[model samples]
Target: LAKTTQPISMDSYEGQEVNITCSHNNIATNDYITWYQQFPSQGPRFIIQGYKTKVTNEVASLFIPADRKSSTLSLPRVSLSDTAVYYCLVVKQAGTALIFGKGTTLSVSS
Candidate 1:
């Protein structure tokens, strides 16, 4: 598991692009995209897990780049409906229980 550093809170206006970057040292090759989301009182839900590339879904876009030590989760056109608690997790190369970043709170307003 790698120690991660990221912002704890972010504010964005409606239809604004928000980029939250999490940097971890010594991320493994198979570490993949380590992004997750947790709603209300539910458990952390896996959102994206990818390699050193760019992956995009209907919700957000993730970029691992070629550095392998950092990743950026991009939310396009965020709205008040998108406010939630999102976090980054780095699964170990051995595929065992691992670590996560101090979650981030994304607040969107009109």
Candidate 2:
């Protein structure tokens, strides 16, 4: 099974766009790649999911390449309030407890 890996931290200025990438070299056929954002002391909120190509929503855009070995999450025109930890997980279905690693902490400054 492919496990996901992301950076431990990232820094960005307010009003700037940010992109975080994760690598999942061994992603399984039945697994779906999901991204989540979490604020301090709060549970993670789903950002996007994709098996291939791209998926976009109100908060972010997810881009997956053909090899399925990596994916990127793009946050546009970020604000200071957007500072949070981002997680990428590969799972078989929704509502499952994601096996989390140390997530990437995004710091947005004004």
- Top TM-score hit: 2
Q: Model 2: residues >4 Å from true position, as ranges?
A: none
Q: What local distance difference test score does each model get?
A: 0.82, 0.89
Residue 74 in model 2: shift from native, Å?
0.4
Please write out the lDDT profile of model 2 over residues 1-110, one tens digit for every residue.
45789999999999998999999998877778898889999999888988899998899999999988899999999999999999998878554567777889999988
* Top-lDDT candidate index: 2
- Please report, as a residue range, the 10-residue window in candidate 2 with the lowest summed lDDT: 92-101
For candidate 1, list the clashing residue pairs, or say none: 33-49, 33-50
On residues 1-110, what C-alpha lDDT tens digit does candidate 1 reach at each position? 66788889999999999998988787766676578887777888877777778998888899987887889999998888778888987785567675766689998998
